[model samples]
Target: MQDAVYGVVSNYYQNKVKGNHEVGLIAVVHTFGSDLKWNPHIHALFTEGEIDKNNKWFKKISHIPYKYLRKSWQKLLLDIIKKNFTDIRTKRLINKLYKTHNEGFYVNAERDIINIKQASKYIGRYLARPAIAEYRITN
Candidate 1:
């Protein structure tokens, strides 16, 4: 799954990049959710603009078509998962995977923030830090 995202995003820039435009990608693959849920996702830190093969700067893409990206990611994910498990006829759990094929996946790309320092500060607080994480149960 992680590889699929890396493939799609990397390919998009590598192929779509024109003239001297290049883009560096930094992506992180996360498997769990905020409330300790099993929602898998990826977070990418992309530069605002493209850097040329000769190290020249170019204007960033004006608008990121998130819906298009999401659709692409979902297809890639489905293809990858399908290759691994192919017992849909016998395995009940495996069959459920295809059931959600029509539902489509999600890809959330945040707005490009120009301020690096402010973004780091935001991430420092927003990214989870561990501990005191005891689950309370009442009987």
Candidate 2:
């Protein structure tokens, strides 16, 4: 699935893309849901500019096809898992995966990252903070 995410981004960035320069972004993998449940998802942080053929930075992408990105990621993950697991026991697991795949997957892209000011502040508070915050305390 990791490779799938990377491939989806890389393919779009490398091919079928124009105008913007080739840019690199960071992908973060989170396997838990918002309510602390078991839901696997990925958060992709993409740069606005692309690294051009000449290695220059271009402006960010204005319009992104989020649905296409989601489908591409889904297809990649399923393809890899099917290839790696050919055993019977794993077959059942694969079946379950397929069933869940019907529900579809999610891919979010942040296009308006003009500067790193807000991100830097977030990091400072995130890293300096503890696992549980005061808000989690109950009466």
Candidate 3:
């Protein structure tokens, strides 16, 4: 799952984001949700834009559309799973999921950091945190 997420994201940025330019990304994998359940997801911190072959970085003023991202993510995930698993039942299940979700998989670009400091802080917070904090647990 982690590999799939990284692959799809990189592909999206490389191909769709800004033509054929390269994009930098830092992916963090979270295997558990706030409820301490197995909810695998990727927290990827990426450059605001892409870097050209001339070694110049270009900052994008606009964000990628969520709809397009979601669909692309879904397709990539399914393709990865299909390549990895050859079981007919699993393949059928994946196909069913693809068919059931018209909007594709969820790919959210939650928040954007305005500067390098903010980006560093955001990364630090997530990296330093645990799967579920003790403060969030209540009876």
Candidate 4:
């Protein structure tokens, strides 16, 4: 899952930045959501734009390609699944998913993080949060 998030975001930035230059990011895997169910997902904080090989930022992106990202992320994840498992049923299911989700999987991001402080806080909030708050867990 971590690899999936990193791969999808890296691909997006690499295409945008147009170089082998690195894309900085930190991805945290959460096996549960706010409700504490076994809902697996990733929370990632990364640079909006990347530096080029010549040590120059190509541009400051105010927005990301959401549509492109959704499709790419879906494809990559399905590919990963396919690679990991060689079962016929799994392949059939993956094929069906490709045809079914024409618009691709859902991918969301904040419109803008504004600054490192905000981004740090946002990621930290999720990382440090408890599955069940202490007050709620009290008997």
RMSD each, Å: 4.4, 4.1, 3.0, 2.0
lDDT per model vs. reference: 0.63, 0.65, 0.76, 0.80
Q: Once superposed on the true structure, which residue ranges of model 3 sit more than 4 Å away at CA?
A: 6-10, 13-20, 132-139
Per-residue lDDT tens digits of candidate 1, residues 1-20? 65776666655666566665
TM-score for each model = 0.66, 0.65, 0.80, 0.86
Task: Give lDDT: candidate 2, residue 87.
Answer: 83
User: What shift in Å separates residue 27 of candidate 3 from its native position after superposition?
Assistant: 0.8
TM-score of 3: 0.80
**Model 4 lDDT tens row, 30-135:** 7897788898777887777776668776555556688987898898999999999999999999989988998998887767788879887898888777778787
Model 1 scores worst on lDDT over the 10 consecutive residues at: 129-138
Best candidate (score: lDDT): 4
lDDT of model number 4 = 0.80
Worst 10 residues of 4 by lDDT: 55-64
**Steric collisions counted per model:** 0, 7, 0, 0
Pitting candidate 3 against candidate 4, the one with the higher TM-score is 4
How many pairs of residues in model 3 come into backbone collision? 0
Q: Which stretches of candidate 4 lie over 4 Å from their true place?
A: 52-60
**Which sequence of candidate numbers ranks them by TM-score, best first?**
4, 3, 1, 2
Model 1 quality (TM-score): 0.66
